[model samples]
Target: MIGLILAIILFNFIAFKTNRRHTQNSILHIWLFTIAFQLIFDTMIEFKYHGYWYFDKEVDWLGLLAHTLLIPPVNMIFLNWYPLQGRLRSRILYTLIWVAAIMGYELLTLLPEPWGYFHYGWWNLWYAAILDPFLFYILIKFYRWIRSLEERI
Candidate 1:
């Protein structure tokens, strides 16, 4: 609980405060897209499949806090820092670094009780590792598409 709360505060602060690149509209779009995407993915994996869940195996309202507050800002921060103009190799490397950080954080969230909010049933870090790059790719593509739309508008 404490861990998740602190992380939410810190991540939101960093994401919003340090954002010099995206406009308010863009940020709003990104936030909405992230929440919707996460909810869809979690609904399938956490609920339908019972792969993993937040706080407990059963559905809980507290888990919504983790879903709504924690990850979108992290995604914001990620897109904010992404090297859009950099070489392909640099971009790939940057993504891998973020994946490692995410995996590390996921590990921390597997800790007991008050500190931990995440749990696994059949899912594991390896699954996340495989999925994250594709996820990041999707985010990048979405951001680019949004940017293109913004340019036309």
Candidate 2:
């Protein structure tokens, strides 16, 4: 609880300090994709499939927020530094770094139950570790496609 809020505050502060939203349209597009992905995956894993669920000490809203609030800035950071036209090796390295970070964070949520927001039923860290790279690659490709369209206009 304390840790999660502090992390969010710290992340938002960095995002604010960096002024990463150079274009409102671009931010909106990224946020749309991020929120959509979070909601869909969260709903499936947490609610529908019962693979995992979130919990907070205070309220249910706080639980859902684990996905919504934390994910966009992460996606933004990933999209922002992504090598758009790099060589295959560079792209692979970049993807690996982001995926590793995502997996690391997800694993952190398993910190001794009460302080953590996530509880797994069938889902495991390995699933997250594997899926993160594919998810990031899709998002990066979507970002590039959007940028190309913007250039056309």
Candidate 3:
């Protein structure tokens, strides 16, 4: 719980410091929408089907809180640093880097119960490593689409 709160605070602080452009509000909104969908999907998969579990069976709310707290700022930071003008190679590399980071984080969460925030039931690391890059790709594409749509308006 302490770790979760600290992470939220750190994420928010970084976002606050770096995400200053008024123009980015739209990007932030898009990120929020994407992360919200992720949370809902995760809830169904992790809770309903028991794909994974958090902490113990007792304080499951922290799992929800963790997802809600972490994702938006992560998306924001990813976009903030992403090279909007860069070539396909640079862009793909950037995406891969973030994907690696996410996979590493997931691996950390897979540690033993008291230290680790999460434990896999049916889920495993390889699935996360493979899917995370695709997920980030979807988010980047979605954000770009939203930008283009707003431009047309």
lDDT of 3: 0.74
Candidate 2 lDDT, tens digit per residue, 92-145? 899888778777777777776555666788888888888888888788878777
Per-prediction RMSD in angstroms?
A: 0.8, 2.6, 2.4
Off by over 4 Å in 3: 20-24, 57-59, 112-115
After superposition, candidate 2 runs with Cα above 4 Å error? 19-22, 56-59
Candidate number that wins on TM-score, 2 or 3: 2
Candidate 1 lDDT tens digits, 11-115: 999999999788888888888999999999999999999999998877899999988889989999999999999999999999999999999999999988788
Taken over the whole model, the C-alpha lDDT of each candidate is: 0.93, 0.74, 0.74
Candidate number achieving the greatest TM-score relative to the actual structure? 1
Instruction: Give the lowest summed-lDDT range of ten residues in model 2.
Output: 14-23
Candidate 3 positional error at 90, Å: 0.8
Distance from true position, residue 105, model 2, in Å? Answer: 1.6
Structure candidate 2, residue pairs in collision: none
Best by lDDT: 1
| TM-scores of all predicted structures | 0.97, 0.86, 0.83
> Candidate 1 at 106: error in angstroms?
0.5
Relative to the unseen true structure, what is the C-alpha lDDT of residue 16 in candidate 2, on a scale of 0 to 100?
Answer: 53
Ranking by lDDT: 1, 3, 2
lDDT of 3 by residue, 19-97 (tens): 7532665756755776787867776777677777677544366777776777777777887788888999999899888
